[model samples]
Target: MMEAININHFNRHKITEADIIRRILSGEKELYEILVRRNNQKLYRVIRSYLNDEAEIEDIMQNSYIKGFTKLYQFKLEASFSTWLIRIAINEALARLKEKGKLYHISERAEELNKNTILEIPDKKQLNPQDKMIHHEAKQLLEKAIDQLEPKYKIVYMMKEIEGMSLKETALALDLTLSNVKVRLHRSKEMLKDSLFVISHDTHIFEFGFSRCDRITERVMENI
Candidate 1:
């Protein structure tokens, strides 16, 4: 398949992620652009993973890249360039999150809208076809579940599930240990699964949750 060939080409590069780090360390600034371009779209998804808005995605991404470039010297080459970049992206998102404090705030508004406009929890009697759709009903529940998450856990959910950030990158981004990232990510995954499962079947939750979108997807799970 064509997909197989493309993946093969990427794998053939074999320079190893560590090689990219060395390139950055050796003053090959231009090469850093290669990494950025390769992952730029993905990095955008990563930023949106936690930040959750299209308007600010670019600002956060650019800021993250600048930070990564400035800190390129500190890169130890112990992990893939992707991992390091992810950490920078996450830290930048976290910083912006603190500044705006709108991530959770917006979610709160969404919850209110869901409660008031989206769902009525129809008492005792189920309605007809259109009413059975209950589309927003499920969404309200899912949003409520997400609303209950701590900021840190919310980041984990976004990075791990939404952006697909790997455990290593999540830990590095938060400057936490691998075990901590794993624990948090695991909890986030379970929490998400449980949250959505309440409104629908497991298969539906899995598909709806993982489907790709115009928003960025970091695939953090790949490296993990």
Candidate 2:
């Protein structure tokens, strides 16, 4: 199929992020689509970690992408593009929070007051319709619990656990020390009920699906 051939062609000549940036800077503006498609899910997760409103999240994502494109010249090739982009998205989220007077201090000591707990859900590969419904409900419960966590822990959880970023990458993106990243991740797990951790790995949570992905990609491409 054409899709398979395209996939093969892409794999055979995969471009590095830095290379894409270089080409984009050199006037191959269309290459920016590659970056937008690649990082859409990540940007969504990071922004969602701060604000729950879907419309607002998409607005901030658009602003972040436009800002990133305008400031692309300042981006250093030595650094991770995703990390740099995430920092911008985080800043945008924080600014929105500040505007709404919702910005709050993040204190490690405050997290210490919460007791550790764990919740488990059944995991089965082949499920009847009833079992599938139960699984869906369980995942929803886990998502709600994650949503209730303090912003400090929630962002770490989103990046490290949901997004599957390395501890170092998470630290770099968040501008936290490695130990701080580890501590926050550990604390996030504790607060989430360790047993529910299985669901994160097995199922998609906080998904940014294909339709939305295409919309963001098209919009960013249009503006940039």
Best by lDDT: 2
- Cand. 1 TM to true fold: 0.55
Using all chains and alpha carbons, the TM-scores for the candidates as numbered come to 0.55, 0.88
| TM-score of candidate 2 to 2 decimals | 0.88
Model 2 regions more than 4 Å off: 1-12, 105-120
Minimum summed lDDT over a 10-residue window in model 1 is located at: 214-223
lDDT, candidate 1, at 191: 51
RMSD of each: 8.8, 3.7
- Encode model 2's per-residue lDDT on 74-184: one tens digit a residue: 999877899999999999999999998889955343343334544447666759887798788888877777787789899999998898889999999999999998998
| Clashes found in each candidate (C-alpha, N, C closer than 3 A) | 5, 1
Report lDDT (Cα) of residue 207, candidate 1: 27
- Model 2, residue 194: C-alpha shift (Å): 2.4
